[model samples]
Target: MASIHILLLFLSCTSFVYRCDGACAEPESDTQAVVGRGFKLGCLSCKRRSEVKATATVEWYFKAKGEVDFVQIYTYTEMGPTIENEHFLDRLDWNGSKRSNDIQDASIYILNVTLNDTGTYRCFFNRILNYDNYEYTTVVSKVVYLTVVEKATRGTASIVSEVMMYVTIIGLQVWLLIEMIYCYRKISAAGEEALREAANAEYLAIASESKDNCAGAQVGE
Candidate 1:
């Protein structure tokens, strides 16, 4: 009996993973929940891919870590989200649109998240789309991967920190460019001074030779 129970649990978990990936043909959503903090599960159905039936239902399922079973957390209809699950009875709030006739924006807000609430959540919309007198029943879904943590550190840089970082980088680049220019000018000036000295030396040598030749001609005369 224990082995049978374990097998059933394993199948349930595997089945849940398969269902979350297989049935969700719509856009996906994801979120994070810090331990003891609140978070939001976002789902948008704006300009829906298809028309919904008059009596459509929205279902939300959750699969926790190390667990093979997917729990039916909450559901929504024209009335609102039904708090049927014990785990999310008081913690779940309907943050989605209240339009049952045309259900869209199916988001949910979770309060006081705990480590046990971390899992994969899948949302499904079972509707009968109108198609030229034929009512086609279809299921559109979105998968939300929610992670819960016991300790969450704020890793996002503040606005001032980001601005300062950019400023520092730009300053370093400008300083490097100035240094390069200064070095180039100093090298060029040194080369020009060496050329000037060599030219003066050559001119003095030519003048001395001309005087010596003049003295030799005078003595010969």
Candidate 2:
């Protein structure tokens, strides 16, 4: 029982770490945004060393279809989100990590989007990793080309990818459950067999002792 509990605890810890580890993965964001709807611009920049303490500031820039150059629109830091452009005032909100200084996901949400919002957006992460001896700085950036549309449509590839992801997740979970059940059954069978062997040995020892007593009593009489 103690061994089973320990195994369960270890499995729980492993799963927690697997789910919580904000490992860097640069997935492409959806390019389509429906007008008059809220859209989230995805951005992720995970630290290579999670154990090392770090602080990050995120900056967002935008360049319209006929723009000369990119203009800074939004910025977020420990102080909170700041909208630098009046065009995006009260329209942009930080949709990423809120509680920690080590910001991993730097996504932002745009409310009541418009055709004017169509452009190329860039997310920049300026991070400082604090080590015992010194601090190291690193910069990472991700760009997304977005288009405003009258109606939202899902691409065939996106739908297929989502379906495949769900299938894979369910398959892995089912396999893990089956493995756990098999392991429990095997352990229980071994334990029962051990108990049965011990019971048989005790019975045999008691019977042999009674037979010796009977023989001694008959000899005395």
The model with the greatest lDDT is 2
Clashing pairs in 1: 13-68
On the 0 to 100 scale, the lDDT of residue 103 in model 2 is: 95
Clashing pairs in 2: none
Instruction: In angstroms, give how far residue 104 of model 2 lies from its true place.
Output: 0.9
Query: Across residues 56-175, which tens digit of lDDT does each residue of candidate 2 receive?
Result: 999999999889799999999999999999999999989998899899899999999999999999999999999999999999999999999999888899899999999999998998
RMSD of 1: 18.1
Residues 1-221, candidate 1, lDDT per residue (tens digit)? 44477689999999999877733233555466688888888775543554344446778888988889888988888666697689887998878767455556677888999988888888777766666677766676788888887887554455678889999999989987987788788889989999999999999999999999999999999
User: Candidate 1: minimum summed lDDT over ten consecutive residues — where?
Assistant: 22-31
Q: Which candidate is the best by TM-score?
A: 2
